[model samples]
Target: MGKGRAPCCDKSKVKRGPWSQDEDFKLISFIHKYGHENWRSLPKQAGLLRCGKSCRLRWINYLRPDVKRGNFTAEEEETIIKLHQSFGNKWSKIASKLPGRTDNEIKNVWHTHLKKRLSSKTNLNVDEAASKGSLNEEENSQESSPNASMSFAGSNISSKDDDAQISQKTFEHILTFSDFTEMLQEVDKPELLEMTFDIDPDIWSFIDGSDSSFQQPENRALQESEEDEVDKWFKHLECELGLEENDNQQQQQQHKQGTEDENSSSLLESYELLIH
Candidate 1:
């Protein structure tokens, strides 16, 4: 038969609560002389009335000479937040980037303070977007029944959410791009106003669904109907202009193609100007 899982500790035999100063000393003295290669046996060798798990925690979190005590520095806190972003809930990994800080400590600080700080910033961005979109979002209490002007807090997406969830929820915000607008408005210097847009020259044909490989499912039916009407209109124009079905047919086709290309180019240029 397979060996059963090894027990971590015995609750009845070893100390469970906070480490006393003597407990700390023994754990530290033993680790200082003999490194903690195997934590499961460290406590028994050190002669502490505690489990190896307890000894490990005490040494790592408090008793070690290199462990930083007192409140964390602002820089350290910022580092933890950035590390959390990259590492998710891997506290041990986050702690490694931060010297003298334990995973447990980092985990605690994240839940207690850092989470709300992040959520508040996300909410602020949403509120700013809403204000930019519509004046109806604002409630001037003074204008209605003599009430004071008030704004409600924006809805918050939980930090527990994964990247995909955040992306899906914030897609609407992505389309509006209020943040870019704000950045442009904030620019006071002349050089900052300069901008450029690089795009494919043939994208208009793709939008028209002339490209066999690409068509958006939501607008596929509408595009087909629209294409039919456009074809009819162009044929009508050709007839009204008295184009021959001979050499003049080629010229008519060229004129139609030129008009379509010019319209697409103008549309793109206008979009670029709006962004700038």
Candidate 2:
């Protein structure tokens, strides 16, 4: 294991706990006047008794003027949950996607509020994976614990057939339950007839292609910025959906003239409908 960062100052000497108004003023004032490029020297230079780390946290989480102080907006919270799904426990990376929010604040919010919200939203556990004890003895044994949580990346769920198993296609990557119900409701109720796919060539390629050979629409060149996380997620979802449907069609001998089955085709339509 790597050595931890050694404390810069003696712990007993530095002040701790809630910052006084004067301390806040001093930290903010010093930062504004002479930027906090070097946090180690900041406390001594600013004439504050707090440690450099404390000063940094104070400025970042509480003292920053642009810091959003009120309750998080609904959209902000939703963004956090989605980002968490994409990047587990990567608070700084997640915070980077959300402007004016510090990693510390986001971490606290997740622990205090969002964690419960997510659990309530998706009560899925790893028991489904553990039940397939034959797959990997070690993996299943570890997963059988009560505290075991589901990490849905490439996770599998067993089917009714004892001899045969069905691949779950990493339900997390395909359609996260957070938005799955929402998507299903839209499918069940076709209120919005107006829909279009202003899809990036990169994303549309997976959806519009025929057979195993993937084709880029219009032979369009894909730049780095052409696609994003959500786009990639949908692309994977569509590809897996097609493969799953195709497999079912083969099993049931329900092949049509087109490469994709009816269910996959209808799903593609639904996806393209809400693409915009």
Candidate 3:
């Protein structure tokens, strides 16, 4: 015998497979009239032949008013990529940041499309070479001069995957000081080497202050200009609507005045005819 209890609904009585148009209408109408309190009992209340779980999925994924269908935008794709990198496979958390997108939808898109695209584009060989070169240079500098600070020139590695790998390797190499020292000791003649790692004080200052340096004055001014334009657009819309309302009120007043004048003229003409 099965360990668990019997199923919630009878499989024969409750419908299965794709939901019809009539089923969608009933589910939407029932939820709109009375909100989804108990999902298990929702199908019974809504007169749906399907199980509660099925009804819930249909409502959440398709029938809900706010559910956004169709293709994802470029901004949405970027957000998904960034959020996935940070949170891994936490689709629900990722979906929360992107309005109208569901966890299931995001998961499907990532697995089916984005993952393949990323894997196909990633390259690892060039990254390993660059990292090895940097490590060797740093070790040579330390062996040649104890007081020297290490410096590395910017690499022209355009691929994001290559950059990521380089960073990972550099971080790991920094953590292993014993390996660095051992490599330095292996050098045939330590005294004969004349490697210079004399990093300038100005370079140190630049590196330390890079965070603030990136937020340039021109970028801030541009952001402010964008905000101002948005405010101006909203104000223009308000002014146009106000003018239209005022014009409508004035037109109504003029029509009322004209009707009163016509009524008075007819009454005066009737009075004159009666006197004659």
Instruction: Give the whole-model CA lDDT for all candidates, comma-separated.
Output: 0.48, 0.50, 0.50
The estimated TM-scores of all candidates read 0.43, 0.43, 0.44
Angstrom error of the Cα, residue 145, model 1: value is 48
The C-alpha RMSD of each candidate to the native structure, in angstroms, is 27.6, 21.6, 28.0
Best by lDDT: 2
Candidate 2, superposed: residue stretches over 4 Å from native: 1-6, 124-276
Per-residue lDDT of candidate 2, residues 147-226 (tens digit): 24322222122223221121222112233333443443342233421211211121222222211111112322231233
In candidate 1, position 196 carries an lDDT of: 14
lDDT of 2 at 212: 11
- Per-residue lDDT for 1-276 in model 3, tens only? 667977877889999999864466467445544557788898997788989989988877765543445556544565678789999999987766654467889999999877875565354445766755664575465545632222221122223434235443323213122332233333213341221111112222221222111123444444344443323322222222222333444433433343334433443343223222
Poorest lDDT segment (10 consecutive residues) of candidate 3 = 195-204
Q: Between candidates 1 and 2, name the one with more favorable lDDT.
A: 2
Could you give candidate 1's per-residue lDDT for residues 165-245 as a string of tens digits? 533342322211233223323331234322211011111111112312121245545434554433432332222222222
By lDDT rank, best first, the candidates go 2, 3, 1
